[model samples]
Target: MPKNAKKKRTQNYKKQIGQVPGALIYTGAKEGNKLHLHVFDYNNEDYKEGDLDSVEEAFRFKDSETVTWFNLNGLNFVNEIETIGNHYKLHPLILEDIVNTSQRPKIDTYQDYIFIVLKMMYYDDSEKIISEQVSLVLGKNYVLTFQEAEGDVFNSVRQRIKTKKGRIRSEGADYLLYALIDAIVDHYYAIIETMGNKIEDLEDDLFTGLTQEEIAQQIQNLKREVLKIRRAIFPLREIINRLEKNENGLIKEKTTHFFRDVYDHVIQVTETLDIYREMIWSLMDMYMTTISNKMNEVMKVLTIIATIFIPLTFIAGIYGMNFANMPELQYKYGYYIVWIVMIVVLVGMLVYFKRKKWL
Candidate 1:
């Protein structure tokens, strides 16, 4: 069998294990308890924004001359999603991929539309990294974006469109798609910056003599988070590369340069992640070496004490023998003499150790 067919079979098998056929199963968090739709219709001369109650209402503007951006803020409503897919004539596989939420970043081009899947990442108020899937379906004159939850990383894009601040409002739907993707990519910089700060804090703690187990736990946590970010952003390079060289006419010629810019940003993010991962590994190794050296230092002190007492113990043991006619036992001051000799031997060993710098 061909590679694609085998992979498709595997995916189907996995999905079928606990899923009903033709069912829409949401695989993400339940934060987006309610469904909401925000539409932005614009052209070089006009712009409008509103909330739509149904997917049919959004489709009304699809045939208009202006470009329409349908932003669905939640994915838990499977029925509504299936309705929008049916109205747009979207393939079932694409719909399934959109709701899966665990999809790797990829692109799929069809006859009338181009589908792109990528992650939108951000740092929450507590400085924790959070990620969500953002899927874009680009048609001739409309761009449909399905987000995992109500909130998004597209506020800057919205501001630019509302204020007419950039060429976004002047360009076609392809440009709008680029603008939204760019917004998602730009927030990766913020996540990377947060990771960098964490790495620096870990390095500082390392010098301050933090506990090995504590620092090790922290390093592992940071490493895990970086791996997650890497998984999210690395495949995006290929996705944007395909968009930049798109020949299907779904992406406009003028907008390919904008995607190229986003591609460059993705490269930078990948490189930064690589650097941080290496630094975390180094921190782990440093932690281990410090622990080993501390243990060796303690052992050295113990070994020196044992070395000094060995001969003293031997002398005492020989005198402790209960043999008949022992000369030391017959002496009048044998105990005092043994005491003085042991003290002399101990002091001499201490002097030797101090001279050798082993103390």
Candidate 2:
């Protein structure tokens, strides 16, 4: 994530404090963004799709016999969203959670609908992970999705519904909700696969002793990405588990099986994330160990050089003393003999170190 974007999100979170619980203040950073309203009304026989100019157009679908999918792209417009919420009889807390993009992934059951908050993640053009919050309300005959921005992983689901390629059009709102969530969860595999590749690439060069000093930083960033994905998908596991087992009227008994499949996928994602998290920790430890080993090699070489000089220094110190009875100082070739002796001692130490395999 970009540092600026992260800072902005954190700052926005501060605005939510000391406020009413059900207040419709938008805590997301997408302010001043124009709202995009798209409605997908479909059935087994036919479908109608269009962009609405106002939230009032969505009111007609309140009692729609067919499955209506009201996909609102931007969440900054509090007035428009409020109108939709009021018309649809959504709880105020549900509306608040929908606008609060920082909310966790959760499932809140109501008398008229099932509200689910999910984190939809995908890569931007720069390959940076972008997490968008998607709030869903599944009613008896309609499904409303609120998003922070425009892009999503729901294109395939839309294509399926549009082409009648599968049973989505023939199913009720619960199945639509399932398809939407399944899309997000299925994309999790792609994100996880990307992180796995990163981990493998790092590990490939980690032990070579030729990696750059920034390799540790790379591992740290990778760990953050893994943790981010974990935070997004871990809560989802519990949410899906609860959804699959709930006896709510909005969720059909038959649809529980599909949700069960989704739950399995979430479990796989969380398990992979756990493995990656551990691998990251191991990488950090290995990096530190490598640094320590290199430092020891350096210290060993310096120690050996100092030890070799210790004897020469002792001999030189004894001869450097001012004394009238120094016999070696009176000899003409004494300096040459001392040089030879020092060289021999150095060579002997070198040979001994080599035999000891300490060089």
| TM-score, model 1 to reference | 0.87
> Which structure among the candidates has the greatest lDDT?
2
Question: Per-residue CA lDDT of candidate 1, range 230-274, in tens?
Answer: 999899888988888778888878789889999899999999999
Q: Which 10 successive residues of model 2 have the least lDDT summed?
A: 2-11
Error of 1 at 49 (Å): 2.8
Model 1 stretches astray by more than 4 angstroms: 1-15, 18-23, 29-32, 44-46, 322-324, 327-333
TM per candidate comes to: 0.87, 0.92
Model 2 RMSD vs true structure = 2.7
Give the per-residue lDDT digits (tens) of candidate 2, residues 1-359. 77456433366777788998898888887776778999999999999999999899989988979999999977888888898999998999999999998888999987778899999998777768999999999899999999988889999999998999989999999999999999999899999898888888888887778567889889888888998898899898788887877766888999999999999999999998999899999988988888899999999999999999999998889889968899999999999998899899999999999999989
After TM-score superposition, the amount by which residue 225's alpha carbon in candidate 2 deviates from its true location, in angstroms, is: 2.5
